[model samples]
Target: MRVRLKICGAVLAASVLVGSALHASSKPRENVTNASDRDYPAAKLSTLRGKIAYSPGVHAHSLWVMSFDGSHRRQITHAGAHADFDPDWSPDGKNIVFRTERGRYDSNNTGAQGIFVVNTKTLRERQIQPRTGGLFPAWAPNGKRIAFTGLNPTCCGEVIVTSKPDGSDKRIVKLPTAAGECLAWSPDSTKLAFCGHQGDGNWAVWVMNADGSNPHQLTHPRAIEPAGTGGDSPSAWSPDGKQIIYWSWQPAGGELFVVNSDGSDAHQLTHWDGGDEATNWL
Candidate 1:
């Protein structure tokens, strides 16, 4: 009876349209035929910007990777029903860390919720934290560790934890609150940015030092929407580590926004009337 709650704030607006028909051997059992499969036009950037990895499938989660200019689009996993989502590229761009569910949503649930790594060059896959119910994997800038949200099934929620790339030395960085998730490692790897409920009873973005020290609130709880509006969610940091990008669903629509790491200078980045949610800076 372990219910799966969609990881808030990780969903992107793009559709999951598989570019090529090359399928993987461990493909999950789900229908992606109706998924919107379109690739972003690739463009060249002057610097070696990093790629943005996200799950784009509307019905069934699918993992996709795109360059900073939306070029070099590729699908890293084809786990149909398992719903491979929340992809994070390795710091070196050689692999991706992601999550997947096994079997259909209703029947034959493997409880196979864990963090996995996929080789970008050869399309090889391996489980890094098998059956641990881990998600939102963020690789430390130093490339020695990965921070992710590990669900405590008995506790009915999740917490942030870090481990070596090989799944060794796993340690949970307990949050002040039990509900914190969506970890984003700072560029210097000294802190982790996440979203959680503060003592004020609303969801706001917060940050903590690498060892879970100095838990500071970044966004004011009052920044939340009025009743019936969607809540704010955790998001990615700019390459320079000066700002973070998140989505806020107001009365008009959901839009991407940037805020200083210290919770100052919050401003909108996209003006799509319909809405724009996912944003990652290279």
Candidate 2:
């Protein structure tokens, strides 16, 4: 509960680009810090390759694509007043599924959010068929389904839900805590990693089978003092499916952390200012 409240306070006001870092199986690797979320020098931008999809804005976030080095940035979605975020590219790199607060309502009487898909090349965007309510959409590597935190009243509250890309055949991946968020699928698509409250009432990384079985906690970051707070929010898995990257918070600040897929060798990866987040692994 403390961490959940902190999550709300620490949210970036504008937007954040996904940061990438080198990864290895031997140990936790250092993260490559980006100069600025809004600007990258042309010389530096040319040195990096690949594309990154992110939601960029202060009041109204919308999906955008840019090179890994921050070059050739292009808008992908023009949702105007609606906020679009949590862009997850399909494994094949053809489409992206993300959450949009366009035309839905939540339990709090505020506008609810739902997932929508857009073709990376054509820029055509449409809401997922059959309709679904959720945030932080993650595409399974097998290219069959998208997993996200649910908002449907039938879910009873926030929980992990998986459904076809078109939003049909939905299935809830029940968590022991009854609430969860930030779902990431294993590279092999056999398991899911997410963030949820532990028995101690602190948020921690948790993993479960793709079918929603064998749930277990993976990290146990603790608050330094009684009044402080600690928690871990999983971002994504390494390419080989051997490790997971996440964000850990303590009284001092937040940092990136890495742990083995089997819940071993949990350690910090970044030592910079707190608030360092682990996004796409690249």
Candidate 3:
């Protein structure tokens, strides 16, 4: 997704922190525009499954892959005319799917974009879907489909959609959220967990079958939490496919919370002074 999505309790990586350590035993190939597998001599780097790709700069936010511990940081895309954000990894860990900014936000109030997948080894890129109003791209665990957010003709409501790797056979599933512009595939890739808005003007996390049926709320959390509890963001199913892990906002700040997929045994796992957001399970 190209928009600078706002979370009730979230931190946007809107600014690029200059002077990042770009040191690498073998620097990624020099051609930032395009590359081949030979350009990425380090095959093992592409296979590193636990690394994360995220946008963390001000203008033209570029994608960066780094270890959870903040080591082996590598910047993937050169700052183009627009920024790149919301990266998702393929099941094989060989490529990353993300969105790059396109047209200016106009009267429609949405930015236009296309989803692109980058070869982790070569750093070469290809388009999965034409530049439309698409946002977060989530790869299916079964490797058969990818789920992402697309804008309605009004450039307003975002609907969840799935398509083949090549962007064919598109299907739409409906569940709405003011900030829930994302979907998380279950470990088996049969269900998705996302945020849904309430008529009362609050948001709750909801889950549904992959085909867009059986939608239900998983987080009917209290509207208030001792002057802290406020809201949650896109959620991910635990690796075991047992619980959904997500971040919620509170008076103090954002905190990570986990709840059973069936909406039972909600658990708060942290009490940091400020808060935390779960970007990905890995």
Candidate 4:
């Protein structure tokens, strides 16, 4: 059996309440289209700055947004058992694109997970249909496209998929790796950063062109004895697009690291013996 582990970034001093509804859809794959003519209305930058959105739960994960100082906390999605996570803020900061598990957690179950968008202000939610299913949905900084990782039926591995906010004109990027997840786009929207399951029997941080060209590994983390599995999962990029932040798993614990865009000059940012990761950058 293949077990999947989900680790959310660190947030401090916040209270959460559950019980809200977001539109849930189990739509067929045929709903995904090949046309690119749909036009999304342009959005303006939100005046509300320095706000953070995250999903945390002990029973089941739901969405939450709070101010940068950990105040004005509120729960956005209250799917009792459905795990809602991997939120990426829209360029306008008005909506958040996220992934929701339909019923149960099955990594290989096609259509088991669906991509969704939630209005941060009004709490309105809608599903974004992918060809198969969507995970780790990232809204482009330009607000023109959204990207995710999905299971490839024929190849039996994860493949990168990009589509409009409405889930039209789907395009797939087949990476030279066993599996991939936690996709993040650069500030300029020219490149993508994600966690890839390497052929060398380990996971590493990888960067590639937005169109899935010129794929390359960034960090090569070694496995320690007690932990065994070691890898790096990218979280987000800096505002200026010069650096990338990610989490490196180890026997001691997960530590945050900052690296140059070209995979040079990596340095540790945290020494805490806990799982420290950066999910979003403002």
Model 1, span 1-282: residue lDDT tens: 112124322223311111111122123222222234232111111123455565655564666666644568788678775577656667777877776665332222423366788887688888777555665677887888998877654665567779888778988787876457657788888989887774333556788898888887776635443432354555667677888876565435665566888889877655545454433444
lDDT values of the candidates? 0.59, 0.64, 0.59, 0.64
lDDT of 4 at 144: 91
RMSD of 1: 9.0
Scored by Cα lDDT, where does model 3 land? 0.59
What residue pairs are clashing in model 4?
none
Q: What lDDT is reached at residue 31 by model 3?
A: 20
Worst 10 residues of 4 by lDDT: 14-23
- Residue by residue across 1-282, what tens digits does model 2's lDDT show? 322321221122111222344433233323232323332101111112356665554543666777654567788788678666667778777788876666653446522367789997898887773344666678888899988777545635566788888778988776777567767899888899987773444678899998889988998766444422567878768888999988776535666677898899987765544355535565
Off by over 4 Å in 3: 1-48, 67-72, 103-107, 153-156, 176-180, 198-201, 221-230
Q: How well is each residue in 1-282 modelled by candidate 4, as lDDT tens digits? A: 012235322322100100011111121111011112111101111224756666654554677776654568688887776677657778888898877775444654543477889998799988775336667788888889999887876877778888888778888888878777778888888899988865544678899998889998999878544332567877667777888877677534666677888999988755544454443443
Worst 10 residues of 3 by lDDT: 13-22
- Per residue, candidate 3 scores C-alpha lDDT tens digits across 163-192 of 887778988776645434556789899998
Question: What are the RMSDs of all candidates, in order?
Answer: 9.0, 6.1, 9.3, 11.9
Candidate that would win on lDDT = 4
